[model samples]
Target: MKTIKIIFVITFALAGLTLSCESISNPDPINAIDSTQTATIQGTAYANMDETNDTTFSTKENYERAPQGTNVKVVLNSRDFASNIEPGVDYKSLTYETTVNSSGDYSIEVPALGDPIDAEIYFDSFKTSQTQVDSTEEQRNYSPQQFPYTVRISAGLSTFNDAIYNSN
Candidate 1:
């Protein structure tokens, strides 16, 4: 049995590209069709690490950029042609990793879904804070967001715009 769900996509790919179409019954056109050109994906991540002025939510001003060296995980699976896929590559393979710049932002790219008929994306926004001031004691209090990060890939879709973060 397939349970229906509605997802409001607040992000769009560059150049106003709509790789898939939407319908009243199904919010995602990618799942309905088998072959297409590409897919759109994006989102924001928030974590409480170094909040200046002890603010509750993370903000760019308060938090230092994501230390440019940090890398985020992105996985994709175009479940179509067996030959196209490597000997053992599928979704959750961690085949792709991208770095987050000082702005705590990342652009995720995966094989387009339409090549076969379907593509799924999983982005991991998990990172630990580093100690500042060479502290012997803990740098700061920690409280992580339980829910997965919100996505902002499609121009037509948006949710939780961007994450708030504070610098240590």
Candidate 2:
């Protein structure tokens, strides 16, 4: 009976690892067979885009007047978030970070990587929230929740980022 129990546990553990390893699937290529690619990423960052009847100015106007307002910083990673490639020395620093325009429109051109690879942009709201105490391994002392804007952008066949962000 003990032998059977041990065998079952080992089988289950192997199965779990197998499933986890296959969790990340390679997505379709962003561009065709091009030696290089240049694309523009344009989108809006706001608590909400759904315009209510209370606003007098145009939809563009309201977004500019938002208390959260502008200066929202977002980072663009060279590789997909799920890729096994290590960040190495220059990771986040090498990433392309940009600020949204006053009207909430963020337009930036993706640098030429000289190869076909997945590009991803991570936005964490406008401001950075701090933690109460520093205790983590990196000593970040910051709450991931503070960065409420969790949007993953996968480029399409076209050059435009295609208005992916649509939430508070």
Candidate 3:
């Protein structure tokens, strides 16, 4: 009779342990989906031109001209890069491109999975001129200058005012 009681107690304890483990292992489905939502990034770009021709454009006052028609590229990735280092080439990333408007403003909406997303933003500018020899022909020169930087963005609106110095 004592053996029967011992077996019953052991079976009950095992059932309870199994039930508790199953509940803890499962996660809420709604919360899991909400974590991987989207985010929007918007900002204005400026060209820090050396109006005085002195080759100094390190201050905020020098960023007076708007960088119209500049290409603004945003790359979303899982890791953040150093400020001085260029991003997107070495890692798996998603790229989004937009052109700076006439007013120098740009807006891009990108998928930002995880609580906070990592992004690399940069600008590209080109100078196009019509050649005097051929009225219908034009010359395009791509600027080698660009300012690439990284940022940590959330699931809402994030703003960044970027200024790239004019290397002309």
Candidate 4:
């Protein structure tokens, strides 16, 4: 009976020790903010002219028509509150805007707030000069495109490459 009691006590002690070690390793409370934490969203914005509506294109044409120096905006809206507050309250939201370089590459850094930050990316319209089949240059306008899905970001870099916008 004594031996059994000793074994039970040892098992209980081991369990307690494991729980304590786990708590020690993770001392941060839920949703604890680390001021230095940030996340980067980067991608290339492509402006393709799909006149045929077949959704097929040549690689050379796509590279030549890529949008350059266009604005890209990343927004993170606050989650809905338990009360009557609406989703995406202004006070808790964040917006980061940047312009793509000549290579159609853009990067935006946002604070890593919640456990998983949800953001939406928007591409602004731009005007460029395009050569017509007759060898004449004319100005062409491209419409803005918004990401259809919400992007989830963590503490590191999140890349959303190949953001192609079809300008028909």
Candidate 5:
């Protein structure tokens, strides 16, 4: 009789343990997709305006007169240069007219949805014969301005993981 009671108690305990180990049904998924994300990427394009004898202008004047290129291209892709750019999506130019402070630095505004798109600003100098005087050398040069930087979107799992891994 004692053996029978012992066996019953042992079986009851095992059943309880097994029931407790079973995971409860959750209405929500363990990893819900996060829709809301916000991030910004900003950097300065460092380039002084073309200063030539034909355009006898101060640094500030030269910067101000410098034709700000309208075609500052922003190329964004989901993969890391693995595939070609996505189609049907239009990329807006991030070029704006702003004065370079006494320290030759220009701020270009690049508005974005959540995070600024990965991009580089190429400042293509527009030369004109009217602006060109007797200086032939000045007319032949094209000052291309380029700035490379990364704009991170808001904190995602991948970003956090990267940060933690990098810190370690």
Candidate 6:
């Protein structure tokens, strides 16, 4: 019986030691494709050419003067310029991140790897609700019209300088 008790104590001690020695990892690393090169596109918002409204002004004025206003967004997808891009060959993956700048310029970042990055940008417009206006009185004055915008970026070369060099 004493021998059995000794063995039991030894087993319990070994189990405790093993449990205490276990290692744990904290702060998991973010897993995302590194975009070594970045491409940036900038533009100003304006009323659509077909629209008869002359409420074209800075987002500040538009938001303050009209009941409806528009917001800009940058969009990126797995597409190739001129030709269809194969999912795995021309483009590996896709991720969408959006940012609203204090200067009213909407920015988005996407991951793409290929010769030309094919993408589009859409402008979203909406009419402010009465409740919204009461809450954000300053931004509720714009007209109620929205237009869509599209942007296409060349791949590999991320900057205007690179584009110029390639053309030459």
TM-score of each: 0.40, 0.35, 0.51, 0.58, 0.29, 0.37
**List of clashing residue pairs for candidate 2:** 47-168
- Candidate 5 local lDDT, 24-72, one digit each (tens): 9754222322335423233333223232442444433333333333223
C-alpha RMSD (angstroms) for model 3 = 12.1
lDDT of 2: 0.43
Which structure is stronger by lDDT: 3 or 6?
3
**Ten residues in a row with the worst lDDT in model 5?**
159-168
Write down the worst ten-residue block by lDDT for model 2: 135-144
- Which is better, 4 or 6, measured by lDDT? 4
Error of 6 at 61 (Å): 12
> Candidate 3 residues 1-168, lDDT tens each?
999999999999999999878844552232222434667777766553334433454545544444476888888753332223344435456688988888767888776654666677887766644233223444444442455767777766564646454444
lDDT per residue for candidate 2 within 1-168, as digits (tens), equals 999999999999999999888867674444322224455556665432333332555444443221233433444454433235543523342255566556545666554443344445555433332222232222121112234243433333333332223232
Arranged by lDDT with the best first, the candidates are: 4, 3, 2, 6, 1, 5
Report the lDDT tens digits of candidate 4 across residue range 49-149. 43333334654354343566677777776432112444453446556788888787887777674466677787777777655555566677866455543
lDDT of 6 by residue, 1-168 (tens): 999999999999999999999997674343444466456655443322222232655343333222122443445653432244334454432445443344444444455455556555554443333333224322222322322334456534432200000000
lDDT of each: 0.41, 0.43, 0.60, 0.64, 0.37, 0.42
Segments in model 1 whose C-alpha atoms lie over 4 Å from true places: 1-36, 56-64, 78-94, 114-168
| Residue-wise C-alpha lDDT for candidate 1, range 1-168, written one tens digit per residue | 122222222343422345444333632233332233434444454444543343444354445544454555544333443334345544233245666566666665544432323323333344465444443334443222332233323222222234343323
Q: Tell me the deviation in Å of residue 112 in model 1.
A: 2.3
Q: Residue 159 of candidate 2: its Cα lDDT?
A: 37
Query: Which pairs clash in the backbone of model 3?
Result: none
Report, for all candidates in order, the number of backbone clashes.
21, 1, 0, 0, 0, 9
Q: Could you tell which candidate, 2 or 4, scores higher by TM-score?
A: 4
Model 2 alpha-carbon drift over 4 Å, by segment = 1-37, 49-93, 113-115, 127-158, 162-168
Which of the numbered candidates is closest to the native, going by highest lDDT? 4
